[model samples]
Target chain A: MFYLLDLLGTLAFAISGVLTAMNKKMDPFGVFVIAFVTAVGGGTLRDVLIGRTPVGWMLDLNYVYTIIASFILAVIFRKKLEKLRKSLFLFDTIGLGVFTLIGLEKGLDTNLHPIICIALGTMTACFGGVIRDILCNDIPVIFRKEVYATICILGGTVFFALLELNLPINIVYLLTPAVIIIARLLAVYYKLSLPSLERK
Target chain B: MFYLLDLLGTLAFAISGVLTAMNKKMDPFGVFVIAFVTAVGGGTLRDVLIGRTPVGWMLDLNYVYTIIASFILAVIFRKKLEKLRKSLFLFDTIGLGVFTLIGLEKGLDTNLHPIICIALGTMTACFGGVIRDILCNDIPVIFRKEVYATICILGGTVFFALLELNLPINIVYLLTPAVIIIARLLAVYYKLSLPSLERK
Candidate 1:
């Protein structure tokens, strides 16, 4: 089940990357590279930090296949995909939730400090888009104006709190992702965001 | 000698990052983070790719200290340092040369393909600045213009070719970095760059 969620998250992230690259007028090679980075960049960082080298995508060919599939789908249905803003947003949120939990769990497994685990979760769920935006020559939306990473941190906190309650491990995993997804979806729905400093 | 060169490279990269962040008007924390990233980002990426976990910086605190020292020096003498542009350029170029060789040697140690090793050399020497530019909300200068990474690639190719000739190991090491430094310095001196696509 976790594997399926991981794959789903990867596909969603890849599609998001493709859409962003397309909007940026990147060439085909650039689009594919961006998609691959978006799908796996966060996990790769996490794996590297924790000494889990050879990384997740390298260990499994599924991620590459999924990114390729996503790139093809996005290209074929560019117009249609653009029109499905709500669905795209949903997929992105779900993907963030799963990815964050995966990172949190990985950090936990490494016996890292709880604060570090939360940071790892946030970094894992968000840095892919950060990297993608960097490659596209734009300030990352999360860093500029979004409640995105904050939501991941919050979800991580909840995850650890629930774990401390002696909750079933499986239930904790399920609940953690659910919390992230719901938090993200609500933030989007409410147009919630962190305040930006305005220049005089 | 190699260890000293590595430390110097880290300090130079950190100084460059500090200067960039200062121009961006970031807070001290942000400046430190950027400096840290610029000093270690390339090697971190290379290490991660080659399955060296915990990364170089995490294992040794010297990098951290060097970055801190660079950051402090950059902050204190920001105006005076700006006047030392030529010296700074030389330091940066030398740093790039040594970093590229370190990456190439690491890749070769892992028995990676020659092309991959060359690419690793280029990435290790260049990606720090790329990441810095990205955080500064600019397209990486390397990708947009200059013969920067190309020099590293050229140097890597030369390193391998010389190895095939069975040159003394010490001479080969010295010669590879010398080639990179000279190529980069010449490129800058001549204002030589790859041809950029002109818009119609």
Candidate 2:
């Protein structure tokens, strides 16, 4: 089930990249590169940090095949997608929850400090999007004291805390994404923001 | 003396980044970020790979300050820069030479295999420019079989070979850049290029 979520998340992210490149009128080659980067950039960084060899996509050709498939799908359905923006949002939101959990799990498996795990989770959820925006030459929306990464950090914390409380494993798994999606949705709808500290 | 070379390299790289942002017509804040990233991105990757704590720029506020100063200088001279096409290229070459040496030295300090050190050197010399292009939404020239990174790898190999031959330290330092510059000039003049694998 978790692996399926991971694959879905990769697909959604690749389509997001394809959409952005299409908006920019990029060539097919450029669109493919952006889609690949958006889907795998964060995991590659996580693997590099953990000293995992050959990177995630390099080891699992499925990830590569999925991104390519999604890019082709995006191209064919370009006009149809305009009416499905809301559905695309659903996929993106789910991807955020799944990737965050995967990141936190990987960090725990490596026996890293819990704080670092939370950081990794937040990065896994957001950095690919950030890289996409950066490449698109815009100010990253998540950087401006937004509730973006904070949502993932808080959600990961809730997951581990519940596990310590001896919550049922099945309950914990279900609750994790539920909590994150609700938080993120609220943050986006009402512009819930983190306060910035004044530089002195 | 070694510290001076390092400083010169940092300055040159920071300037190249500033120039890139200028070409994009970015504001002062954007220029500062581009400059900082170009100056330290490669070394930060190297340190992270080696598990070094507090990558060099984070440890030294001076590097950060230097980038800021360079950005200010770039802004003041933006008009002059706009009139000159080759200013960025000149600094980029110097930056590559200095980065190659620093990367080679750092790898030697860690006692990595010679071939790995050469890889490190080429990565250090070229990766920053690759990143700058990516952020600017240009195709990464490195992935295109350009002569750019190859020059750094060739010169790096020469550095180690000369060291083993017991050449004078000054001669080694001077000879490395000369080789890189001459090779780069020849390649550019002759329109040398790696054959691109035919696109499928």
Candidate 3:
């Protein structure tokens, strides 16, 4: 079940990456590269930070195939996607939640501190967009805009809190991603964002 | 000896990152973060790709100390450095050479493809600066302005070619970094750069 969620999250991230690359007028190769980077960059970073070798995508060739498939799909359905902002946002939010849970679980498996695990979760959820923006020569959207990473951290905290309360492992895992998905959807629907610091 | 060289390279990269952050008017935390990222980003990426766990800096806290020292030195000597562009360039070039050699050696140890090794060498030499530029919200300097990564690739090719010739390992290591350093210094002196791709 988690594997399915992981695959969907990869596809969602890849589509977002390809769309961003297309908007930036990158070439086909550039589009594919950016899409691949965005799809795996966050997980890759989490693995590196926690001393996991070969990373997730490297361990499984399935991710490469998934990214390629997503790229082709996005390119073909470009116009339809352009008219489906809500759907795109939904996929992205689902991606954010699933990836966060995966990262938090990986960190826990490594026996890292809970706070570090929460941070790892946030990084996994948002770093792909950070990388995409950086590659496109813009300030990272997370640093300047929405409460994206903030929500991930909050959800991660809740994940640990419930675990501490001796909830069933299965229930805790299920609720964590759900909390993140709900929080993100609500944030987007309400147009809620962190305030940007003004230049003095 | 190699350890000392590694530390020097880290210091040079950190200084360059701190200076760049200062020029961009970043806060102290921002400066420190950027410096730390720039000092370690390339090696971290290379290590992750090659399945090296814990990364170099994480396993060795000495890098952290070197970066902190470099940051303090860069800030105190910031005014003097503005007048010593030549010296800064020299340190950066030396860093490029040493880091490239280190990366190439690491790749060879992993028995990767020669071309991939060359790419790793180039990445190790220049990617820190690439990350720095990305975080500072600019197109990568090497991508548009300099022949930096190219020089590292050339040096790596030379390193492997020399190895194929059955040259002494000591001589091979010495010549590889020398080739990169000299090539970089000459490129800067001649103001040579790759031509930018024009939009059609």
Candidate 4:
């Protein structure tokens, strides 16, 4: 079930990347690269930091193949996919929630401090988007705008608490991602965002 | 002194940044930020990888101030600095050499495998420029151009072998950067870039 959730999240992230590249008017190759990076960049960074090298993406080319497949799918159905903006958003939110939990788990496995783990979770959820934005020549969401990272952190805390309560791990996993999606969707609905850093 | 070498390198990198931003027609504020990132970026990445939080530039702010000062100086004398193209190239080569040694030292301090340390040294010397180019919407030199990264690897090996032979540490430091600069300059002079990444 966890594996399924992880795969679903990866697909969702890839979809988000393709959409972003489309908005930028990039070519098919660019869209595929953007989607691939958005799906894997954060986890790759976490893995590198923990010294679990060759990196997750390098270990399995399936993620690369999947992201490319996603790009092709998006392009094949470009207009229809564009029309389903709300549905796409839903998938992306699900991805954010699940990827955050996975990142938190990976961090704890490395015996990192809880705060750092939570931070790692947030990074995992958000950094792919950050890289996407940078590559697209847009300001990073964390630097300019969004509730994206904050939602990840809130969800990560819930994950940690659930783990501590000795709760059923399966229930915990399901609840954690659900909580994250809810938080993110609600934040987007209300346009919630962290305060900007004042220009020095 | 290490301090003087560092400042000279920083100044050189800052000048390079200014030149790049000018070519792109970036505004003054953009130029300053670009210059600052170019000068300090590699070292900061090395620090983060080695778990040195509040990285060297973050801690000193002097480095930050210096880049800003250099930026201001560049803008105030844009035409003047542009005329010193030869000196600028020499300085950039020096920066490459000095940064490579510093990266190797930091990697070794973390007790990473010697080969990894050498890789880190090359990465540290090259990544900042790659990042700068990416942000500027250019193909990175390390990825496509002359033997910039190869020079850093050669210098890092020289540094490590010197230390293994228990040569005076200061002499090793001095010799390492000197070797890097000479190698890179020679490569530049001879147009000794890597074989074409493109297939015939």
Candidate 5:
């Protein structure tokens, strides 16, 4: 189930990349590269920082296969995807929740400090979009306004808190993503955003 | 001498970051982060990709100190730096040559393919500026126009070719960076750039 959700997240991220790159009028090769980066950039960075060699995607061909499929499908259905924006958003949120949990688990496996674990979780959930925005030549939306990373940080905090309570590991995993997904839904519905720092 | 050139490269990259961030009118914190990233970003990415954990700067305090010093000096001398642009360019070119050699050596240390080593070399020499440009909300100048990475590739190829010739290892080290630096200087002097892929 966890692995399946991870693939779904990758698919969502890749589709989002395709959408963004198309808007930029990028060539097909450029679009594919963007999609690949958006799907795996964060996890690859996390793996590298943690000294996981061959990186996650290199070891698991599933991710590459998934991104390739998503790119082809998204590009073919580009016109129709407009109507599926809400579905895409839900999948992206699901990806955000799952990727954060994965990062936190990896950090705990490495016995890092909780603060560092939280940072890892947030980076896993957020940095792909950050890279995507960067490649597309825009200030990252999260840095500018979204409350996206804040939720990931809070979710990681909750994850560690649950572990402290000696809850069953399965229960901890279940509740963590639940909190993150719900928080994001509420934040977006209410149009909540972080305030940009203005120059004095 | 190699270590000294590495430090010089880090200093050059950091100062360039400071200049670019100031142009963006970022706050002090943003300036410092940019400078740090510009100094270490390429090397960090290289280390991570190669599965070298805790990274180069984490193990060596000198790199961090160099970046801090560079950031402080660059920020303080912003006005005077305009006159020092040529000197800065020289340092940056030196960084390009030295960093590419470092990356190629690391790739060889890991027993990676020569082609992959060339890629690692180019990434080490150029990705700092790539990250800098991305964060500053500009398409990477290297991807658009600069002949920067091409020189690294050619230099890396020359590095292996020299080794195959059984030249003394020290001579190979000296000549490889000399090739990269001289190529870069000539490219810039001639106003050479890569052609962009245009849409019909």
Candidate 6:
């Protein structure tokens, strides 16, 4: 079930990447590369930083296949996708929850500090979009926009707190994403955003 | 001597990062982060991909010290740095040569394919500036500009070819960077650049 969610997240992220690249008017090759990077760049960076050899996508053909499929579908349905923006956003939020959990789990396995684990989770969930925006020559939306990473950090905090309460691991896993998904939905629904910091 | 060259490269990269961030009018904290990333970003990425735990800088205080020192010096000497641009460019080129060699050596240590090793070399020598550009909201100059990565690729090819000729390891190291440095210098002197690819 968890693995399925991971794949879904990859698919959603890839489609979003394709949309961004298409907007940039990049060639097909550039679009594909952006899609691949947006889908897996975060997990790849996390794996590398934690000394996980061979990286994730290189070891698993599923990610590559999923990205390729997402690219083709997104390109073919670029027009229709406009009407499906709400659905796409939901999938992206789901991805945020799942990827953050995966990163947190990996950090725990490696015996990292909770703060570091939270940071890892945030990076895993948000960095793919950061890379995508960078490739398209834009300041990353996360650094300036909505409380996206803030939700991940909150979810991670709740995750660790649940663990401390001696809750069942299954329940912890179930509730963490629930918190993240709902919190993100609320944030977006209410038009919440972080204020920009500037020196006067 | 190699270690010293590595530090020198770190220093040069950090200074360059500082200049770029200052141009972007980033805050002091932002400037320091950019400088740090530009100094160690390539090596950190290389180390992560290769599964080197604790990373290069984490295990070595010298790198951190070098970057911090470089940041301070660059900030204080910003006005005078314009006059030292030629010297700074020389150092940056030297960094490119040394960093490429370090990455190549690491890849060989891990028994990766020659092609992958060359990629590792290029990434090590060029990716810091790429990250810097991304953070500064610009397309990576390496992806568009002169024969920067091209020089690294050529240097890596020469390195393996020399190794195949049964040359001494010391001679190989010495010649590899020499090839990269001289090639880069000549390329810049001749105003050589890669042509942009455009889809009609």
What DockQ do the predictions score, one after another? 0.16, 0.06, 0.14, 0.05, 0.16, 0.17
Pairs that clash in candidate 2: none
- In order of appearance, the predictions have TM-scores of 0.60, 0.57, 0.60, 0.60, 0.62, 0.63
- Chain A of model 4, TM-score against the native? 0.91
lDDT agreement with native, every candidate: 0.84, 0.77, 0.84, 0.79, 0.88, 0.88
Ten residues in sequence with the least summed lDDT for candidate 5 chain A: A24-33
Candidate 1, residue A155: how far the Cα is off, in Å? 16
| Prediction-by-prediction clash tally | 0, 0, 0, 0, 0, 0
Alpha-carbon shift of residue A195 in model 4 (angstroms):
29
Per-residue C-alpha lDDT of model 1 across residues A1-200, encoded as one tens digit per residue: 77887888888899999989999899999999999998899888788777986788887999899899989999899889868777777778888999999888887787776766876798799889878988888756675567888899899999989989999999998999999999988888899876542111
Candidate 1 lDDT, tens digit per residue, B1-200?
88888888888899888877766666554566578779888988888778776667755768777887898888778778868887778888889999999999989899999999998898899999887887888878998887999999999999999999999989999999999999887888899999888897
Worst 10 residues of 1 chain A by lDDT: A191-200
> Which regions of candidate 3 deviate over 4 angstroms?
A1-44, A48-129, A132-137, A141-200, B197-200
The interface root-mean-square deviation of each model, in the order shown, is 5.6, 9.5, 5.7, 9.9, 4.8, 5.2
Q: How much is the lDDT of residue A50 in candidate 1?
A: 72
CAPRI grade of model 3: incorrect
DockQ of structure 1? 0.16
Supply the TM-score of chain A against the true chain A for every candidate structure: 0.95, 0.90, 0.96, 0.91, 0.98, 0.98
Give the better candidate number (4 or 5) by lDDT: 5
Which is better, 3 or 6, measured by DockQ? Answer: 6
TM accuracy, model 3 = 0.60
- Chain B TM-scores per candidate, in order, are 0.96, 0.85, 0.95, 0.93, 0.98, 0.98
Candidates 2 and 3, the one with greater lDDT: 3
- Residue A51 error for model 3, in Å? 5.4
Model 5 pairs whose backbones collide: none
For residues B22-117, could you state the per-residue lDDT of candidate 6 as single tens digits? 999999999999999998898888888878867899999999999999999999999999998998899899999999999899989987778668
